[model samples]
Structures are given as C-alpha cells and as structure tokens.
Target: MKTVLITGCSSGFGLETAGYFLKQGWKVIATMRTPREDLLPRSEHLRLLALDVTDAESIHHAVEAAGPIDALVNNAGIGLLSAIEGTSMDLARDIFNTNTFGTMALCKAFIPQFRQRKSGVIINVTSTVTLKPIPLLAVYTASKAAVNAFTESLALELAPFNIRVGLVLPGLAPSTDFGKNAASRMQNVFPEPYEAFAANFFANAKNTAVVTYAADVAHAVWQAVNDPSAPMRIPAGADAVALAAQSL
Candidate 1:
C-alpha cells in the first residue's frame, strides 16, 4: 500500500483528504497541532501525529516517523483577511512562518527520501488568490504565490528523480473552518475605514458557487497524485476554475 503523509489534518482540507485517502486503501499519516479527542475518524490505515508546520523539530520528527512515504501533501495553512497596511507585522510574519516557510521546509526535509526511492509525489495546496489580486488579503495571497513558484521550480528539479511536484488552487472553499480560524488568529482590532471595507468585501465574496467544498480539493489532490500526467497546477473548486480561466 502507498503511504501518504498529510499535514494539518485536524480539520478542513487536511482532515477530509486524510479520510478519503484512508478509504481508498492507502496508509495515511495525518498530522496536526492540538488534535481533538473527538475528531478521530475510524480507520485502520490512519496514523495521527502532532505537527506544527512552523517548527523544524516537529516536521523533522514527523518525517522520521513516516518512513518511505509515497506522497506528501502540504495541505496545512493559515489564512488572514486583513489589509496589508492594517495587518500587524507580527501577524503577517506568523502566517508566513506557517504557510510559506513551513511548507517549503517540509518539502526540503522529505525530498531526499523521494529522490532516493525514485518515486513519490508532493502536492502543495495553495489558493486561487494568486490568479486574482484580491483587495484585502495581500499577505495571504503572497504566501500562496510563493508556494506556486516553489511548485514550479521543484517540479523541474525533481523530475529527474521521478518525483512530481504539483499545487492545488482552492478558490473560495467556505465549507472549511478557514473563516473561524482566521477570525481567531486576527486579534489586530481593525480601525476606521478599513473595518467598513472588510465588511463590504465579505458581503461581496459570499456565494455558494464561489465556495468550493473540501472534498473537491481532496479529489483534485487524488488526481494529481495518481494520474500519469497531472498538470503542475490543479485548479480545484468552481470559483478557482473560473479564476484560472480568466488568466488565459
């Protein structure tokens, strides 16, 4: 059975992907920070671990635990919705620490194994915000844009070793708890005109079709991993697909 290691599996896209992979008869190593006691899904092929992608020690330990994996899904990420000027530097740094630095660190830590085996796939879950320069989420979009660039560079570097590097653009998957999590992370207390603008931005962006389901992202990841010729970027979600087309 192929072994797949996925990060941030306590909830959202990571949780859904972990469950789906397990159901497909794949051995899954699901990692998260502060894993819930009741969030456990029934699966014999699942191995749950505590992970904070921001920490090198945690990532090192997890990779050591998951030996000779067939694939690595960097599904772990944090979202921020504040304006670039209004957001605190500390907060922006923290988000980049998790989304940008952490994702790249995991790839570096695991690439040796994949290269040695002459196999394995790496799927980095980015956002469709890269395609469209949204107003309020400059920092968040920048981080994902970094991931997209990394995916392209790493794909070429790893091709010789037979490992594939790909990314998924989840346009507006409101089904996940990203909003709540973002709200919790945002203690910045917006002031003045920005607060009103944030409200308006949320109002305009809210729509069912614009939001992609967590399952849809997982399905895209599945195709990216199993397919013989998966594209470097798998555009998931209805809104993401549309955003991708707009670039063309």
Candidate 2:
C-alpha cells in the first residue's frame, strides 16, 4: 500500500483527508499538534503522531516516527484575522512561522528522502484567497500566497528528480475551526476602515453553503497525490474553481 504523511489531523480538512486515504487502503500517518483519539476515525491503517509544524523539534520527531513516506501533505496552519496596524508583529511572525516557513521546512525535510528514492509527491494545502484580496485577512492570504509560490517553484525544481510538488487551494469551508481562529484575532485586528466589514467578510469566507465541504478538498488531495498528471495547482472548491477561472 502507498504511504502518505498528513499533518494537522486534529480536525477539518486534515482529519477528513486522513480518513479518506486510510479508507482507500493507504498507510496513513495522521498528525496534529495535539493528537486526540476523538478527532480521527478509528482505522487499522491509521498511525497517529503528535506534530506541531511550528515547533521544529516536534516536526523532526514526527518525521522520524513516520519513517519513509511516499507522499507528504503539508496541512498544518494557523490563522490571524487582524489587520496590518492592529495585528502584532509577533502575531504575523507566528502565522508565517506556521503557514509558510513551517511548511517549507517540512518539504525540505522530506524532499531528501523522496529524492533518494527517486519517487514521492508533496501536496501543500493553500487557500483560494490568493486570487484576490479578501479584505482584512491579508496576512492569511499572503501566507497562502507564499505557499502557492513555493509550490510552483518546487514543482519545477522537483520535476527533474521525478518527484512531484502539487498544491490544493481550498476556498473557505465552514465546517472548520479556521474561521473561529481567524475570528478570535478580530478583536485585535479590526481597525478604523476595516472594523465595520471584518466580521461578515470573515464569516462569509467559511459559510459552508457559500463554499465546498472539507471532503471536496480531501478528495482533491487524494487525487492530486495519486494522479500521474495532477496539475501543479488543484482548486479544491467550487469557489476556488470559479475564482480561478475568473483570474484566467
């Protein structure tokens, strides 16, 4: 069976994707900052590991625990809803640390193994907002944009080695803690011009019916990892697809 390592399995897209792969008979290493039994569906093929992408030591240990993985899914990320002025420099750093640098580190750590074997795929979970500025979530959008750019660069770099680098840019899914996490920072970031609009915009970002379900993203991820010709970028939601079409 193929082996896939998925980070951030505590809930949302991560957990759903883990279960999907496990059900498909892949050996899955599902990880989270805090691994909880309740967050995952009980499965024989599922191997749980504790991982904090923002924590270097945790990443190293989880990678070691996972051993040789055929595919690496970089999905662990945090959100900050505050605007430029009200948001702390430290807060921006923290978000970038998790969403951008942490993911880059994971790819760096795993690509060596993939290269040695002359095989493997890397799927980085990004966002659709990079297509346009979604008002107050500029920091979050920039973070994902970094991932998108990294994915494109890595795709070209890895292609010569027979390793694939692909990305899934999911539009906001309501059934996730992401919006709440973003909202939590609202009190801090909502300043003058942005204060009036932040709430509804952020909510609409994840209003389920307005977007696709997490399973849609999970399925796209599975397809991206398995398909020989998966595109460098896979739009994981209808919103993403429509927006991508518009951008084109």
Candidate 3:
C-alpha cells in the first residue's frame, strides 16, 4: 500500500483529506500541531504524528518519524483578514510564516526522499484568493500566491525525476473552521472610515453562497495524488472553478 504524509490533519481540509485517503486503502501519516486520535478512526492504516510546520526542528523530526512516503500534502495553513493599512508588519510576517514558509519547509524536508524514490506526489492547498482579489485579504492572498508560484516552478524542476507537484485552490468554505479561526486572529485595526468599509465588504462577501465543502478539497487532493497527468493547479470548489474559468 502506498503511504502519504499530510500536514495539519487535526481539522478542516487536512482532517477530511486524511479520512478520504484511509477509506481508499492508503496508509496515511497525518501530522498536526496537536495530534488527536479521536479525530479519526483507529485503523492500522492511519498514524498520527506531531508536526509544527513553522519550526524547522519540528518539521525535521516529523519527517524523520514519518518514514518513507509516496505523497506529501502541504495542507497546514492559517488565514488572516485585514486591509494593508490595518495590518501590521509583525502580523503579516506571522501569516506568511505559517501559510508560506511552513509549506515550503515541509517540501524541502521531503523533496530529497521523493527525488531518490523517483516516484512521489506533492499537493499544496492554496486559496482561490490568489486568482481573484478580495478585500481584507491582502496578506493571506499574498502568502498563498507565493505558494502557487513556488509549486508551478517546482513542478518543472521535479518532473524529470517523476515527482509530481500539484496545487489545490479552495474557495470560501464558510462551513469550515478557517473563517472562525481567521476572525479570532483578525487585527483590531478597523478605525474610522476603514472600519465601516471593512464591515460592509465582509458582510457582502459573506452574503455570497458557500458551495465549497471540505470534502471537495479532499477529492481534489485525491485526484492530484492519483492522477499522474493531473494539472499543476486544481480548483477544489464551485467558486474556485468559476474564478479559474475567468482566468482562462
């Protein structure tokens, strides 16, 4: 059975994708900052490990413990919603630390193994905000956009070694914890005129229907891993598909 190592499997897309792979008869090494056995079924095919994507030491240890793997899913990310003027440099750096550097660190950890094996897959979970600009997401979008560019270039670099790289763009998934988490960390910088505009913008954005489910993201990851000819970018939600169509 092929083995896959996934990051941030405690909840959201990571958790869903881990469950999906286990059902498909694949051995799954699910890593999160906090490992929770109750979050997933107790199966021989599933192993939970602790991984802090932002820390190089933590990443090194987790990769070492994960052993040989067929695929690596860079799904761990944190989102932020704030205008550029409202966002502080420290806050922006923090988001990039998790959403950008974290993903790249995991890739660096596993690329040697994938290269040596000459057969492996890497699926990165990025946001559709990269394609379509939305208000109050400047930092978050910029971070994911970096990952999108990195994945595209890395795909070409690794293609000769048969190491496939794919990117999954998920749209606004209101049902997921991402929004709640982002809201909790949202900067309290809405002062004066910007506050009213920010409020209006967010309210309007939320009014739009949410068609993206966590399962849809997992399905995209599944296809990206199993399909040898999968495109570098895979849209994982209805809104994301529409946005991608606009780009086309």
lDDT of each prediction vs. the true structure? 0.87, 0.86, 0.91
Q: Which structure among the candidates has the greatest TM-score?
A: 3
Candidate 1 residue runs with Cα over 4 Å from true position: none
User: lDDT at 56 for candidate 1?
Assistant: 84
- Candidate 1 lDDT at 126 equals 94
What's the true lDDT of residue 181 in model 3? Answer: 78
lDDT of 3 at 17: 98
Estimate TM-scores for all models: 0.96, 0.94, 0.97
lDDT of 3 by residue, 121-156 (tens): 999999899998788788899999999999999999
Worst 10 residues of 1 by lDDT: 185-194
> Candidate 1 or 2, higher lDDT?
1
The C-alpha RMSD of each candidate to the native structure, in angstroms, is 1.3, 1.8, 1.0
Q: For model 3, where is the 10-residue window of minimal lDDT? A: 184-193
Residue lDDT tens for model 2, 154-209: 98998888998899989867778776766665565767777667767756654546
| TM-score, prediction 1 | 0.96
